[model samples]
Target: MPAWRRIRSLRVRWLVATLAAMAVALVLAGLFLHSLFQDQVMRQHESALTLQLDQLTARLEFDASGQASIDPATLSDPRWGKPYSGLYWQLDEVGAAPESQGAQRSRSLWDDRLHPEPDSPADGQIHVHQGTGPRGVPLLLVERTVFSAETPARHWRLVVAGDLTEVGDASARFARVLTLSLLALGVLLALAALAQVAVGLAPLRALQRALTDLREGRSQRLQGAFPAEVQPLIDDFNGVLDRNAEVVERARTQAGNLAHALKTPLAVLDQAAAPSVTADPAALAALVHEQVTLARRHIDWHLKRARVAAAQRLPGHRTPLAPVVDGLLRVLARVHDARHLDLGADDMPADWAFAGEEQDLQEMLGNLMDNACLWARTRVHVAAQREGDRLVITVEDDGPGIAPEQRQAVLARGVRLDEATPGSGLGLAIVADLAALYEGSLSLDDAPSGGLRARISLPATR
Candidate 1:
């Protein structure tokens, strides 16, 4: 392909290249137009020469024996008939008809002279030719046959001439103006292309800044502030962020629980050790084994949570908050058997999905609702809503609520306040950590039914 054609085929470089090309086209068009203009002017100048020849031919007359006559003083032009100003004429006699009247013009007979050849009977035709005229003035000539009406056999030649200095000068002046106009247009086009390049590529810069913000954790996901062309990219980027944050949070929570779980056995070992420098190595060994077991269970629970949330890692894996809430309540109904828990919701978008790993969603909801079910003696109330930028899930129970003084401690990692309950306090902590992972928050408040209200808020999916 040609270089210009190749430039147009590219994505990023086409605009500038096309503008530059149009400028080039303008120049070429100007050149062609100038040629057309000059050609028209030249044709008009030649037509005038032909008309002068015809006028001169009309004055022809025959003598008694049929001999051609002349009238040289009749050749006239208002603007160009001045002496030695390049317009001139000639007349002559030949055996039959002159081959060219141009050769018969007499003003520049042997000097910088030229005359047109008049037509004849056998090869009779008017002829125009270019040559130097009197005083070396560049000129054109028109020639034609001048026949006598009285005697058909007796005809002469007539010629007309013109100078081209004035035409050339005028053409040059017009050409200069035309050339300057084309150049100005080319310059303007170039500037316009530069502005277009900046304007067209602005979205790329915005995308770069948005990606940078995501990397620095200034934003949890790519949001609404983006150009339409780059909107899909921003959305995909947000999906990736959602998945990766879940992965990283799961890993951290597992690591933390592993560390927290080892505390009990180590403490027991410290207390049961024999009084020796080795501190009852067998007892210490047993304690270490128990701690390792506890760490293993904690790791297992975290792994399950991670798995449940992993659905969010896949593209378009968003789970609706309402369905999860409803499912949890159905399970609550079954577990309680004779008891009842009301799961009421209104104005929830039916297809509203949570932007999270599926397992993480399951784990958070499962723990919150299961805990609510266990404590809800008369009824468990569950509801969810989209609050500003969050998917808010509130699980409430009609049972006794935790004391305000102990609420903060209960939320602490592995700080189980209910010793009588057959479970770990990792559930609330895990839920809280998952909320933190999504740049969301969680809180505890009094429920309308005189129970504990667990409010879990996750970032709303785009």
Candidate 2:
């Protein structure tokens, strides 16, 4: 199989899917958290720069020539006096060229001047921008346009620019920490998922071992209790094993029985072939015929039982009871037409069906109805009804019925109540055996019409 097709393992499938989802979710969560942190940090940086800008505006001094200056000692922050201290302030003409000379600036600016993006801010309105400062360091610039009363005609832009290196460093450190934390969390969650998959599928592993035991003949059936989720499957498999054993046992028994049944005929034939035996040709032929017929009967009986047993295991064997009964009644009516016997079936629903092969049903019902016709004086009645999951069929005849004590004996193989009735004495026995194969029962009861009632209860489909 291809590599993809080989991924039929349920455990592998679940783990891969779970890990993939966790990875995506953790990555997204890390990104969202980092973005939020960056925004808050940027907001705080802007607010600090705005405060410095406000102080610079309030302490500004302009000469009569509209030149602006500030008292360095007046600023409380010591960084304003330190060169390249990352915090700086400068003043510029509103629409001057980038390098306007004599523009007042803080000592922190040193030789480099702040070049903020050109923007016409309304009076007292602050605007923020990103710019570069000394040594190509990134800076966040917060600027405001101011009109001093000392130099109202000459508006100067007051700007405070702070180096963003520290903020970038802080954010980088936070990103690294967040990544490590989320990776750790993902690892823990993955381990948890792995453990859960192992625990959840443990029952399947047990089931596999049980199957191996059964296959190896270490046990007769699957053994051991399982989780509720897997218990039903275990039960069904065990049931199948039991049924298979039953089939094997039945086959063995039937073989032995058939052998035992044929032993007498075979021995008789063996004795007849002896040199010491002296018999006329007609007598010899008659004896051979009788023994051959008896062997054939035993063979047919075992074969019918085997066929029914095999059919019992198969599914979807629905034979409508009404149709089979009708067909059998038609056949038996003609077979016993000389007696002018009343052979008919009681009113049964057309949907009443037997859960077995049609041939098996025919064999069972045919034997019963045929026996009833033989002994019936005036009427042979066949009726069926549904009792829960069972199909109850009763064949009754209005004639001299067998005694209650002889009913069970009559169902035994080759047990005929009346030898004068002219039968192989296997009809009722076959019916009883066939019914038993279907997990059904054959019973003899007193019919309302004062005849022997052969009642059969077989599994039904509808």
Give the alpha carbon lDDT tens digit for every residue of 163-190 in model 2.
9999999899999999999999999999
Poorest 10 consecutive residues by lDDT, candidate 2? 95-104
Error of 2 at 339 (Å): 2.4
Off by over 4 Å in 1: 1-30, 33-37, 40-44, 47-70, 73-159, 163-290, 300-315, 338-349
For all candidates in order, the CA lDDT equals: 0.70, 0.90
Which pairs of residues collide in candidate 2? none
Error of 2 at 188 (Å): 3.9
Q: How does candidate 1 score on lDDT?
A: 0.70
